[model samples]
Target: MGRVLFVTPPLTGHVNPAVGVAAALTARGHQVAWAGRPEIIRRLAGDGADVFPCAVPRRLPERDASLKGPAAFRFLWEEFLIPLAEAMAPGVRAAIGRFRPQVVVADQQAIAGGLVADGLGLPWITSATTSAELVDRLAGTPKVAAWLDELLDGLRSRIDGGPADPRMSPHGVLAFTTRELLGPATVPHQVRLVGPSIGGRAPTCDFPWDRLDPAVPTVFVTLGTTNADAAGDFLRAAARGLSRIDGIRTVIADPGRAVGPMGDTVLVVPHVPQMAVLARVDAVVCHGGYNTVCESLWHGVPLVVAPIRDDQPIVAGQVVDAGAGVRLRFGRAKPDRIAAAVTRVLDDPGYRSAAEKVGASFRAAGGAAAAADHLEALLSG
Candidate 1:
């Protein structure tokens, strides 16, 4: 049995998918372990998961909500990704020495895994929790892409590693999306569009399941984990907009407690069992986080996507291009616009049809099982 080590960041979206893949590997009689933030890995992968501790910045101050476009991209790489890679380099190396796995499954955002593994002459595969990087969002912006290359070069030098693109592994990439959503975007040969790794996440907080009314149209609204600070206004707008429509229930995830109070018709909470809720909802309204968008589509639920920053616009574009949802301006969307988008998605059957089509493709792509198959192939090859 091959020993597989998954190296992920502390982010829930990234780790959640890896959890599913690791579980698949374990079920196949292969040994699997994790190297990341122990607290988060344990929470999402269950306390029994074999995990090695890693260090993150003591305090990662939230990004300015107004930052967008190129600025946001630069900030993500410089402020978060680079620092995170550097901070994690030692832990990743130590984990490699201790766990001594034959293969490493590295989260695209967690470059340290690739860098450290490359330095130690071990094979690594990218666990692409999101499909944004796989399609090359920077293809049009040569200068921006060049700038990023330089930054990565500097990061590699700091970690004393040879040249290599940490984002894409030469061995393989387990992309959590498929061509159905990606449209005609040119994908690299090494990428395996294995669909979203949906299950195997340790159960999260409970929801008020009884509050959901099957008679009324239900819309699940969320901005995902990282965007809570920027989500307050959008969540309020969504609630107001959904309220304007009669016989519609809105379930909003307000992780930051941005929304104060709401009536029984609108359920506001700090968090929701997202996957469980998606199964019951008629529609979704979200910030277009790839994971959330993919999960919603997995359940054949249409969406109203308001993209904020960092691959969200690219993901939102895919959703619109696929005819699965409507896009709204994150900052300028008022209640009327929000309501209008939701109304269009909820009333029009075409959106749901598109989402169901995408969902069908996802199921056929084999999800985590296919991802594990590819991993085993890598070892055999």
Candidate 2:
């Protein structure tokens, strides 16, 4: 059995997928160690994998918090990334040396993993939570492109004495999204579409599968764990949109205190087992994160995606094109428009049928087991 070191972002979205891969590795008798935050470390430990804490800033000070908008974006670039990267570099290097891993699997956010792997002359794999091309595509835009260039330049400067070009990094990229979602692009030879690594032991909670009335079509609303604040607004808008629908029950999973009171048809809960819930729902209203999209597709549930930020737009666009979902402009969204979209999705049977086909394909891909097999092959090679 080979020693594998998995590095992930502090956020749950990134950590959860990595944990899935780690669990698979451990099951296969390979030694798996993860470097992440304390909470994630605990979760990884629970999965029977050794955990190492990556010394990145897991929480921001209350005084330093900025409301989401242009200000948040600016703060992320200027205040967050610069300092966080600097502080994290030593921890990444130390972990790599101490673990002496045969292979390093890292999230895209932890660019330091790639740098450390390169310096140590070890094999490195890049795992993406969303579409792999998200950063590159965003950087290609005319206005925001410059900022992306500067960010890359800054990362390069931190790595080497002088600014290092991003193209010089030699690491294999593994996208956790499907080809249908990522679209066709001339990705690097090292880049591979490994499908979504979303495996986990079934939740302890007793999901109310029996209570779901199949006669009345159901829509599951989830904003994901990280961006629950944005999801709350969507739930309110969707509640208004679905209010008039006679036989539709909307289930909103709001773990982040974003969801509020809705009509009789809408059920608000702190959290629900996503896959279990998706299994019972006819459709999903989501933020279009790769994990959620893949879960929805895996369950054959059609989608109404309101992409709030980041790679959400890309995922939303792919689902829409595949005839499995509808992508709405989040900025201009209102209750009526959202309702109309939901109506269109539910009224048509084709969307659900198409989604089921994709779900079958996703299931056949073998999820994290396949991913582990690939990593094992890489380690041996």
Candidate 3:
């Protein structure tokens, strides 16, 4: 059995996918060590994987805090990536000195892991929960992307002790999304499409899924755990859109600060087992994150994607093109538009039909087990 070191970012979205990969490795009798923030350590420990805390420069920001999207991205780039890489440079050296491993698997957020692997002359592989070129593609938008790129380049220079090189893409990048959504032209040979790595959680929730009224179409709205503040706007739009539809019920997940004021047809809950809710719901209105998108597809539920930040827009576009859903711009999103999109998805059978096909293909791709097998092959070779 080969000893492997896995490093992930502090965010739940980034860390969740890695948990499944680590668990799969452990189940295969390989020794796995995790380097991440405390929360990630706790999560990995809960899954029976050994944990090693790798302190990032700044803790993840509160879910509801208000900051301009660009500014927030800049803050993450500077505080977390730059300083974290500098700090980890030494820690990684020390860790290599102590527990030497054959290979390192790193999430895209933990670029330091790549640097450490490079420094130690070990093989490095990058695992991404979202699209790999998401930031670079978004940077094509005139001043906004340019400004962000400049900031990131500066950070890279500081971390690497010199100017940033344009050839610095991750050594081997693995994306969870499929080729259909990402398009053949967009993905390069270096990036491997491994399908979605949605961990090994059984559908064991005891929620009353059968109780949901079938006569009235159900719409599931979720913004995930980290970004509940964005839910308020989405929920308000959803309530306005679905309020007029007869017998329609909307269930929201993580309605935290957005709970108090809701439409009569909407049910507000702090958390709902997403897969359970999706099993009963006809359509999903979401922020287009990879986990939620994959979950919605895995359940064969069509999507109404309203992407706010990061790679959401790209995912939203993929959904729209694949006939699985429609994409709505967050800034231009309105109640009528949301309602119309939801209605289109629920009323038309084509969307759900297409979604089911994608879901089946995803299932056939072998979920977590296939990913683990791929990792093992890489290690053995």
By TM-score, who's the top model here? 1
Candidate 3 lDDT, 82-183, residue by residue in tens: 666665555555555566777778777777777667655677677778853533555356787677567656655555522322224345666676765565
> What RMSD does each model have against the real structure?
1.1, 3.4, 3.8
Best by lDDT: 1
Tell me model 1's lDDT, rounded to 2 decimals.
Answer: 0.90
Measured on C-alpha atoms, candidate 3 has an lDDT of 0.70
- If the candidates were sorted by their lDDT against the true structure, best first, what order would they fall in? 1, 2, 3
Which candidate do you rate higher for TM-score, 1 or 3?
1
Instruction: Write down the lDDT of every candidate, Cα atoms only.
Output: 0.90, 0.72, 0.70
lDDT of 1 by residue, 1-381 (tens): 899999999899899989889999999999999999999999898989998888887777589999998888899998999999998988898888999999999999999998888877899999888878887778899999999999989988898764668888888989999889988878899999999998998888988889998888898999999887698888998888888789899999998998877788899999898999999999999998988999999999999999999889989999999999999999888999999999999989999999999999999999999999999997776
- Candidate 3: the clashing residue pairs are none
Score every model by TM-score: 0.98, 0.86, 0.84
| TM-score head-to-head 1 vs 2, winner | 1
Residue 186 of model 2: what lDDT? Answer: 57
Q: Give per-candidate clash totals.
A: 0, 0, 0
Off by over 4 Å in 2: 44-47, 58-79, 132-135, 138-150, 156-169, 201-211
Which prediction has more favorable TM-score, 2 or 3?
Answer: 2
- Could you tell me how far off, in angstroms, the CA of residue 270 lies in candidate 3 after the best superposition? 1.3
Sort all candidates by TM-score, best to worst. 1, 2, 3
Question: Any runs in candidate 3 off by more than 4 Å, and if so which?
Answer: 44-47, 58-76, 87-98, 132-171, 201-216, 261-265
